[model samples]
Target: MITVKAPGKLYIAGEYAVLEPGHPAIIVALDRFITVSVSEATLQGTINSRQYAETDFHWRRSGDQMIFDNRDNPYHYILEAIRVVETLALEMGRPLKIYDLDINSQLEDQGGRKYGLGSSAAVTVATVKALCQFYELPLSRMDFFKLAAIAHFNVQGNGSLGDIAASVFGGWIAYSTFDKDWLRTVLQTNTFGEILASEWPGLKIELLHVPNELELLIGWTGSPASTSRLVDKITIAKFAEHEQYQHFLAESQKCVQKMINGIRNHHLPIVKAEIRHNRQLIKDLGFFSGVTIETPALQELCRIAEDCGGAAKSSGAGGGDCGIVLTDHTVDQARLISAWNQQQITTLPLSVFQLTEASV
Candidate 1:
């Protein structure tokens, strides 16, 4: 048996703007991980889990296809990972191996509450990693990231794969979105061998350094949000090319650059100012898109964090989910945590996932 693990992820800045090719976003891989175990078993291939055992998935192989007799299942990411690996193996003159996979996650609480920390992305990455190891595929980090991303995009239809990239390469990263038109071309070809033989020019992933004195605290609203749904809503709003959106994109990109420079220089004040500026810019973008990017709880979290002398912003799509706070060592994190608790927002205990091989 082979096992692989991947971390959940969050956005530090540039959430909506990174959907376009040139705009870059900051992402942090979380400490929480999804684990996948692959092995041969006596029964038909099954997805076993402690938290989700009640909703287990079992399928049998028919020729090169995995037949899920009961088709209405929730683990589309896992299912797609399996299919993608199987497709690649068969095309490479290797047999598609049949195996039972056991999956588990620390991203969800016992009460089944999701923390909105990119559980799907983590699972997709872990699943692909296990399959790659099992099949002895000679894949580099970018190659692995692209395969997992294609699996995720096949299921979701749209994404920049920032979360998938973060899960694979942990810690903080500055990432540019892949070219969707080029990705769609590869998808149309549906040939893994072609992907193996080609170099993808549209994808960019870079590791970022965080100041040792910097403190990042995450506050969850105790409610889950849908990133894909929110993206769709913004898409339907059709402000992609609007003049105001261009302004927001331009300004937000500048703020991110400023934050990057501040971190590199260890200038906390500029970092703080740019974070708040980025937050306000994102709030304004929500206004233009007519979506609640900053929900009441998230806004409250930021107010509390700022009151404690830290800079804060709602992370990710932000209808709900977590908000992030950044400050220096002098900030009263205890007071910030207490105030968020008073507002019914739970503070998440997180460390950046630091698997450099995965993330670098």
Candidate 2:
């Protein structure tokens, strides 16, 4: 049996801009993860009968394309993973094999509430790893990231794939978005053969050095944030044309640089400053876009973290998802937790997920 686990991710900075070409985002792999176990099977495709069994899935081939049974199924990533890996095997002249896999995740609550950790990305990463291991394919972290990213992009048309990078490499990472236009064209126009013929383009990923003095904490607001809806609320603008939006991106770019440099150089102050700037910046975006970015609970979480001598802000889409907290050990974590509990926010237990030999 091949058992593989991949961690979910937290967005440190660079949310919207990362969607733009060549823009960067700082993302970290969380200790929370999805686990997949695969073994040889008599079936020709995937054999999953766990949490995913609750969802509908179909697997078959079309004229020239290998299509998922249910393209709109929420578990489409799982089918995409199997299809992509199978395409790789055929391209490399390796015999395709069947496998039975079990999927499990730790990113949600017992009541099925997602903590806003990147669960879909995590599952896709795990599926990629499990398939590679089952096939005895020795793919490097970057190679695995590309394959996993293809699967994710196949399901969700838009994403920076920073979560895939973090899930594969783990720890702190500064990631640049890939060429979305190229990938979209390929997926839209190509068949299974064409997809295998077009190898993945190299995407930039840098492992960031986190300061020893920095203490990271994750807290969940209990309400899920729909990132797509929030992005839809904003109007994309040219930097020179829309003055306010231009200023927003400019300020965000500066904060991104400061965050990358601060984390890399062990400069806590710069990182902290950028964190606060980003929180307020998102609020500003809310004001201009007329969409509420930070909910009352999220605001209270940030307020409590700031009052406790730490900096805190929403990690990703923000409407009411998880927030990242930065501080030193001197801050009373218990007090912060108590305050959050009072506001009904759940403090998440997490750390940077480091890769090891056996886990993959």
Residue-level lDDT tens digits of model 2 in 280-360: 887887777677878888888999998998988888878988888998977999999999899898888888887777655
Q: Candidate 1 lDDT, tens digit per residue, 1-360?
A: 998899999999988888877787889998999999999764478888766767858888778788885665778898899888878877777777678889999998779788988998999999999998888887877777888988999999876789999998888998888778787898787598687567665567888888888888999998898899999987766456488888887988788888878877878888888889989998998898888999988999999998899999999889998999987888998898888888999999999988855333
Cα deviation of 230 in candidate 2 (Å)?
2.6
User: What TM-score, computed on C-alpha atoms, does each candidate reach?
Assistant: 0.95, 0.89
- Candidate 2 worst ten-residue window by lDDT: 58-67
lDDT: worst 10-residue window of model 1? 195-204
Q: Supply every candidate's count of residue pairs whose N, Cα or C atoms clash at under 3 angstroms.
A: 3, 1
RMSD of every prediction: 1.8, 3.2
Which numbered prediction scores highest in lDDT against the true structure? 1
